[model samples]
Target chain A: MDVLKFITCGSVDDGKSTLIGRLLWDSEAVSLDIREAIERQRKHNGQETVELALLTDGLRAEREQGITIDVAYKYFTTKKRKFIIADAPGHIQYTRNMITAASNADVAIVLIDARFGVVEQTVRHTLLASLLNLTQIVVAVNKMDLVGYEEAIFEQIKTKYLVLTNRLKLPKVTFIPMSAKNGDNVVTSSENIIWYKGETLLNYLETIPIIPPQTAESRFQVQYVIRPQGSDYRGYAGRIQSGVYRKGDKILVLPSDLPSEIVKIEENLQEVETAIAGQSVVLHLKDNIDISRGDSIVVQGATVEVGSQLQAYLCWFDEKQALTNGARLLLQNGSNTVKVIVQSIDYQLDISTLEKIEVEKATLNAIVKVRLRTAQPIVFDTYNTNRQTGSFVLVHPNNHHTVAAGMIVLNENE
Target chain B: MKINNKSFDYLDALEAEAIYILREVAGQFERPALLFSGGKDSILLVHLALKAFRPGKFPFPLVHIDTGHNFEEVLAFRDYLANTIGEKLIVRKVEDSIQKHRLQDPKGRFPSRNALQTYTLLDTIEEFEFDACIGGARRDEEKARAKERIFSVRDAFGQWNPKAQRPELWHILNGRLDKGENMRVFPISNWTELDVWNYIRRENIMIPSIYRAHLRECVRLESGQLLAVTPHIRLEPTDEIVQLPVRFRTVGDATCTAAVESSATTLEAIIEEVIQARVSERGMTRLDDKLSETAMEDRKKNGYF
Candidate 1:
């Protein structure tokens, strides 16, 4: 079985947690002990039935507040596939948490309350999903039971969501109307909604084809140099960011642009003739070219933009620190961490409006386009082409907190 | 390495991600150490570490914070595995820390050294100035751990502030930390209990004999949980011990790690049991976590792994 990572996001009280709880309950992922604990909590809280949302609220503060504060990862497996659910908080203040969850998710489950139809939070989530390049979007119109299982409400919400998704240019989207609290159309088809005939949420997740972006450029950044003691062996160790590398393949070392031929590829200490993307391997070069960590090894003739100045989209994460022009920070991409200075702030994104707003500085949870100049030239591809090579994080030099996440954006003229 | 198949196996994917995290631990930190507990999870970490850095000696040494109240079988296996790998192993005892600090031992029938293990762990980190401590913690084990970042940063005192955790984006781990602070890296944070067992079966990795079913003298609790009658636990007058075929789902301090009756002598059987088992590994086996609602969260805040 393969793994599929997905995120569930919505406004507060849209039942994102309840929806995940229902899925786990129906899938038998909820253990007996946890079920008992939730039942006990239900009685303590003077509730008639067990509160399924209590399952994901792991922290004491969250349990007391009855809200999810941070992203909680839940895992379950069926015969078809293994699923990783990032149950992110829905509060507007926790948008950074939602962005963190979306960074690695294959699909985005944007929950829309049936009673409220399509809200601003719904539009914001869908827009962020589009920005993160999540091709598959599942618009879960939840709380159908509260709305008397009305077909008109579901249709209206679906239409409203489609308009926003189209505006964002989202390629693939599936709308499912369900009641998370009543266990309708979540793991099983809902009988209350006879007008709906789509597959259950679980079914879609199990059968969804995880199509990874196709890239021809082979890129590998050396994370560490493996030179065992008392041995004449030398190997460049790292995971292949994209494409494949075969023995005897001519490769160019980044920055220095030194030429080398792959003499051997060692995966799990065993010699292999080829290595594909995502596989960690040790590459033995024919010649010692003064290579070390933070150096990239790319297939010769592969188009990789190498430069000191780069234009990218930045998502500010620090609550106290704001992003301004001429701010010096550490840009860490792949295995390389270089000193970088923000040259200019092009525009800040209005998440709800989906419009670019002119700004001098971007605050917390702000997404902005900016230009940066690195201390040294680094090799990268557009984030659209290669997510692994193009994505980076900016770290504060003194406090060492991750300040922002960046995605490289290349101009057509460049 | 050759792409003969279009689809990727979940185990292969988990393994690749784990190896990548291990490499990042080696690449990012100035002094890193792998925390080995002799449990299946940490054993799996050792296996992944070999896959990660084999031609070269592991960039870091294996460190184990021994809570003296540990199973002899596990301790023996820990040493054996470390020796076989031909890597340096550093063992620090909680007993030593307790004695040096004149700390009070937990008073109970099954006095757990779980909480005290953190003191020794933090002391070890300070002693070695290890910037990163790679562990085998999985998010599926507990609630608090579910929200934990892969590259979790801790303060000088080794306290984990869940609310202030740095946002980990994509695979780019932010291992940058100030002096006196360290990172607690969980490479297998995504692997579930069943996934670990399945991977072990697929790789045919050797685990300690305690993992397989064996007849052991255990005191049956009123809650139907079986506590191994180890020397660490204070046997009561009314306690009844019986020999039963039992296996440890998770290897922890002898006093707090409960056993479950099972007849699964093979890895396949263990995997099958894990798939069908209703209770989670922690819910079923970890007696320490049953003490309170936020037991894991509390322990993490006080620097316990």
Candidate 2:
């Protein structure tokens, strides 16, 4: 069985958590003890429908307030698949939490209330999911019973949602109309909606083909230089982010463009002929090139963009301060962090309408475009090509806190 | 050996993710140590770390906070594994902090040194100045641990502000630590209890024998919990000791950890039992969690890993 990491995003009172609860209950993922605990909390909260949100609301503050704040991860396995749901709060810090949840997610479950007919949060979450590079979108139009289980309403919302996905360039879109509160079209398709000819939410999720991302040229970012005591071995250790490398392949070290041939590839002390993406291995080059930590190596003919200037889209995560021009921060990409300055603040994105508003400063939760200058030339690919090489985090130099996240935009000239 | 371009199943993907995190800890942090308790999770972590960096020796050493009331079998197994692997092992006892006035042992019934182990851990970290401590804490263990970040940052006093954690993205782990602050990295944060058992079954690793069922004298607590009779736990007058076939779900301190009546003896039996078990692994084993609703969260805030 494969694992699917999906996130449920919607505004408050949109049945996001209840749908998750129904899935767990129907799948028997929620055991007797956990169910009893949830029942107790629901009674304490003085609620009716066994407040399934209590299961994911793990914090004391969030539980007491009956609200979810940070991102909470829930794992469940049906017979066919294992699922990891990144359930997050809807209203406040929505973009930040969605980024945290959707960063490594394979799909996004955008819950829309049928009565509301595609609210603002639906658009914002879908856009954020698109921006995070999640290609699969499951638009679960929940609360169908409120609108009398009408298929027309579901079609209207899906049409409008498709218009938004078209703008966001998300190709894979799925729509299922269901009343999450009544278990209609969730795990079992509702008989009331006879016109809808789609699989149930769980069935679709279980059977959907997880299209594998295409592999690009091999990009190995050296995380640590492993040199044991008394033994002279300069092993550049890291997980290969993309493609594959075979022994004796000619590779070029970044920044300096130093050329070297791979003399050996070792995985767990045993020399192997080849190394693929996601396997942590140590590589020994033939020549003693000037290789250090934070340096990346690529196959000889692979094209890697090496520059100091970057056109990037960044999200401000710091509530204490805002991002300003000439703001000095550390730009961390892969395992490397270098001093970087904000060259210019470009424009702010109005998430709801997908419109650009030119702005000079970015506040907390502000997604803006900016140009940055690193102290040293860094190697990167476009974010669309390879996420590992193209993504970076902005760290505060004074406190060493991660303040923002950025995705490098590919310039047409490059 | 095979250059396969493909996705992964549940366990293989989890193993790769954990290995990647272990590599990051070695790459970014200075003076890091793998916090080993000889428990199953820690043992699995050690095995994964072995696979991560083996040709060039593991960059970090293994450190254990000896809670002084561990099972003899577990301690012996711990030493054997460390010696067999030829890795450096550091043992910091809770008695050291008790003598140093930093910690005090409990005297009442259901006395738990679980909370006191934090002081010893912090002291050991300060003594060695370890910038990162790799733990085997999984998110599926408890509610509070569920929301914990993979690379959880602790303050100068080792307090975890769960509300103010740095958002981790992709495979890029940020390991920047200021002076006096450290990180508790959980490589297996994404794995569940069932996943751990499945991996253990597949890998066929050697663990402590205490996990297998055996006839042992146990006391039935007033709260319907079973307590293993150890030298540290003072038996009460009303306590009823009976020889029952039981096995330990988790390997913690002898006094605080509880055992459940079981007949499962082999690794296959344990995996089947785990699949059928209702409560979580810690729900029946850990005595510290039943003290309060937010006991794990409270302890985490006070620098307990």
Candidate 3:
């Protein structure tokens, strides 16, 4: 099965790390030393019982401050599938971290404290998850034991979360009521929740019939040109970011309009007949015209567009200052990067209501539509069609920091 | 033409991801080198590098920091593999750094030169001006490594500010750094010890013979730690030397890397043993890691790869 990557996020003190620790523990993924260390640290922290959160709070500063200061990636596996969990802090100021985690996640597990149901942080994380196009959302209503294991509280939170998910246009949402601290409804069936008739959190994760990715146009951006010593091989090696390519398929080199056919495809140094999304392979064309890093290959008859100006929706990441009009930055589109100017900030979306609010500057976590003009014409597609081609990140030209993540709405001249 | 839509096994997926990361490093960095240790992880990395850009020679070179206490078999295997692959292998000895008065060697009965290798590594990087140094550090091995980015950026002096990492999202690895700064890339950051073993078994990759069980002279310490009786080892009067069959979990500094009593010589037995083991690979072997709670974390901040 394909590996599932997801993020577990919630407001602080909502047991995000505890949930992760419990999952790893029940799955038997934690090593003996780490588990023993967790026990020792818990005792030192004055807790009579083992504090599961200590297992994930890796950095010393995080443990001392009792908060997750940065995003940490954790992995676990069950018999059915392999999983990569991105544990990001739930604080509102760490919106950039949440965005980073959500970008690659196939699903988002947004935890809601049973006592504090559907708060502001919950809405922000869900909206950001939606913005990142996470296919599935699982709202784990935690601390059910603290709430007396009542079904009514779970229903109330579920009702509120349903309203929020509807506003965000989230396609799939699953609500599971469980006590992460007590391991109820986490790995095994819970007897306390007699009214709940759904699978446990782990079971649900294992059996969710992973929504297949959309069939995008075949797009392979040339990452490196490999010319072997004392050999006749001139291969363009890169990952097939989207769609699929087969041997003998006609391809058009974008931005150059050069025609070619994939004479051969090599996977891990062996010739292969086909390559799909997410696999890196080297391709040899029948006749190499001109190619290097930053050039892309699309199906010959595919309608891949090229434009110098684009209308984009971007999440401002830089905390130093707000994103304003006429700002200069380098736009990194896959392996290609070019200088770009922020032409105008059209409007910022008020996340809570999903309404358009007029804003001249994009503050942190503000999702705004803006116009951008690049130095050169770049090949791209709508983000809805192909994420690799449609997305670009703005890097601060002066300091080389990524300032914002922009998704092309469409080419301006489309 | 039909495109193959087969899903990869866990190990295959990991290998593909590692290769993908190596390609990105090749495309981004002006000068890059693989930080090759004679350990199993580095052996796996060297094999992956061969597959990553094969049919063609690797664009980057392999670098090894000789701690001067490495196992003779491991060093010999490192050279043999480098020669077999026909790649440039650069060796920088920590003894050279000590001779140049750049670093101070510890003077103790049972001293490990593992920590001092960092100075030689930094000096080598500065001398070569390598913008990216790929290593075989896995996240599952340590807590601090779990929080690091795949493309971990370091300052000009090679300090790791755990808090100030670039937001690496999806496939866009922001490897943008200035002149003096460099990025430490870990292609197999997600692989576990068992995964590495499985890959080694499946790929039939060659590794040092010490990883297999062998009879060696060992001394039992008061703390229940077993020390191999190498020529460099300082023996205490009360310590008793015994011949036992053991295998090394990790092959690092000879003084610090302890061996576990096991007769599992084949790769399959090793994998089975790893699957049934309780302690982590490093926790069971690396004495340097047991000194403090954050020894790896602290060393990493000082440019230890």
lDDT per residue as tens, model 2, A244-266: 88999999999889999999998
Question: Clashing residue pairs in candidate 2, if any?
Answer: none
DockQ of 2: 0.66
Candidate 3 lDDT tens digits, A96-180 = 8888888878778999999999998888888888777775888899999988999999999999889888877778689899989
lDDT for each residue of candidate 1 in A26-131, tens digit (9 for 90 to 100): 8988999999999998888898867888778889989889899999999987778889999989888888899899999999999998888888888778877777
lDDT of 1 by residue, B1-305 (tens): 22644345678778888999999988888899999989999999999999988867889999999989888999999999999999999999999999988999998899988888889999999899899999999999999999999999999999999999999888899898888888999999999888899889888899999999999999998888999997788888899888999999999989988999999999888888887798989999988888899889999999987
Model 2 has a clash total of 0
Using alpha carbons, what is the TM-score of model 2?
0.96
Q: Which of candidates 1 and 3 is the stronger one according to lDDT?
A: 1
Overall local distance difference test of candidate 2: 0.85
**Worst lDDT window (10 residues) for model 3 chain A?**
A208-217
Give residue A126's error in model 1 in angstroms.
1.4
Instruction: Chain A only: list TM-scores of all candidates.
Output: 0.98, 0.95, 0.96
lDDT of model 1 at residue A192?
A: 96
In terms of docking quality, how is candidate 2 classified?
medium
